[model samples]
Target: MTVDKESDKGPYICNGTQSSDPEYTQSSDEVTLTVAEKPEPELTSDLKGAALTGNSVTLYCTLKLQSAGWKFYWSKDTQSRETETETNHYFIRSVSVSDEGQYRCRAGRGNPVYYTHYSDALWVTVSGESPPVSLIINPSRSQHFTADSLSLSCEEQRDSTGWTVKRYTL
Candidate 1:
């Protein structure tokens, strides 16, 4: 049997002797299969809000891809990235005042990957520490009052003029 090689198609046999078998006379067709690369995961979360100084806050990021399985990574602003290969959730154990900043995440299956970042900065503010100031009231010893009332004001020492005092009667 003589084989014929064609550039457009593939190898074929042009047997010198005509074959009585139909299989030998027929040519086999070839099909090409292609698999697309999966897209990178997307990071989704709300990082902007007011949080207490020592309170724990959770920042979330999600990866949406064509494939079911993937790895997730979390990174603080300008810091080294942390990878969570097994799970989708990223947890911040104790969110501190300094820990407040922009955060991002990346997701991919393997190398040659897709990475989606958070579009806007997750702005977080740490509740201020300065405690509210207390006011002192002193009655004049020289003055004796009968059936009289006194007015005292409680003002914040930081910005005394800016404070609005509210009185509560018990």
Candidate 2:
């Protein structure tokens, strides 16, 4: 019996074989399997608005990848230190004033293919221990106070930045 050689066209032909050879076909399929590189991870923080003093804040870093086979890394801007590889989330428990800085993350399988991406710098400001306490007089109690006239003044004991003054009469 004589067997005809397969044409070298299309995916069906493997090493010029008409009959499907398990070894040849299996090896060929293995070669065709593609391992896609994971995309860079996205970094985000749970901090927003003004952080309050003595507040336990969790800074979350999320790693979104095109491929599932990837590990995540987290870091702060002050130092180029990397945290442990997490599959999903990274957190900073009981955040304090000192923990304020920029952060970022990276997604990678191992060496050579690793990539890093930085997130926007978030300024974490801790609120004062007490709300801005201020004393104001609807009508100023000056030495020369005149009747039927309104004079208003504001006195803020605490130092505050970005404060707006308003006067209301009842």
Candidate 3:
């Protein structure tokens, strides 16, 4: 019997009776069946934002409760790309603009092949140019007095909304 809903989970018992001169009955131990909804695998990438062209990136597909005998499947832009793959990590040796797309993954295991829901899409963008960032100091000069006031700013060739400034001093 195939169970597909939570409401079907409960305890079950089998009873048997025999008819003769004296009626006899026997009862077996109760057996409980538990059912749970299939979980969706989580998809993640090493690159936090746009990936530079010719750079390598790795995508990982994982489940909360990991088990053995799972085969992973990867898709790009809703198109089936990999099927029945043994590894959970998808490695891209080199990425290009043509590789940019919405990627997703799913896992399947066990006999009769039970499959989990597809993971959330991870959008990958490939940039041809490398991100350029420079630091600008106001009152441009080689020497600065002890109390001299100076302004430090960060400039980027592209968008600087998410850029961070860091400095190391002895």
Candidate 4:
């Protein structure tokens, strides 16, 4: 069985251009670094949609090659080192407006380690404005039988004047 390096890790994305050195060579009297050259680490995020303030955000550092025994480092825009991970990912809990910004990561391996160049930077943003009202559906089921009707409705909280209920046929 192969172990997955990304399992149970938070989601992240690399936003901008990535830089990878073609070859990083380090040799010792008894050992030579013969591992195949690896691509630049990739930064990624789990925000599929809009990210609002006060939510958790997960960031990932991914290597195209095996990431075993690699140490990862992270940095935010215009800042020194933010943090480091022994593994290939990092988590941001309770993200606020301050957390919205560019982030980058890189990896290093072996003693007196040779480091991979930083991955592309990612820009993160959080919205503080109130979210828009959304419609809700009744009879919450994954699959519905044909010819069966479902109830759908939306309500506006302002002055109680924006409540709407409608039905349509599929």
Computed on alpha carbons, the lDDT of every model, listed in order, comes to: 0.56, 0.56, 0.84, 0.73
Worst 10 residues of 3 by lDDT: 161-170
Q: Model 2: runs farther than 4 Å from truth?
A: 1-30, 33-38, 66-69, 85-87, 111-113, 130-170
Better of 2 and 3 by TM-score: 3
Put down candidate 1 lDDT per residue, 76-144, tens digits, no spaces: 785775656556666655557787777666665557754555334455566744335565444534564
TM-score of each candidate structure, all chains considered together: 0.44, 0.47, 0.63, 0.55
Q: After best superposition, candidate 4 residue 146: deviation in angstroms?
A: 25
Give candidate 1 regions above 4 Å deviation.
Answer: 1-42, 46-48, 83-85, 111-120, 128-170
Per-residue error for 15 in candidate 1, Å, reads 20
Residue 20, model 1, lDDT: 72
How much does candidate 1 score in TM-score?
0.44
TM-score of 4: 0.55
Number of residue pairs clashing in candidate 1, backbone atoms closer than 3 angstroms, sequence gap of 3 or more or interchain: 0
Task: Write model 2 residue lDDT over 63-87, tens digit each, in one string.
Answer: 4445566666666774677786656
The residue pairs in collision within model 3 are: none
Q: For this target, which candidate reaches the highest TM-score against the unseen true structure?
A: 3
Score candidate 4 by lDDT: 0.73
Residue 117, model 1: lDDT of 54
> Which 10 residues in a row give candidate 1 its minimum summed lDDT?
1-10
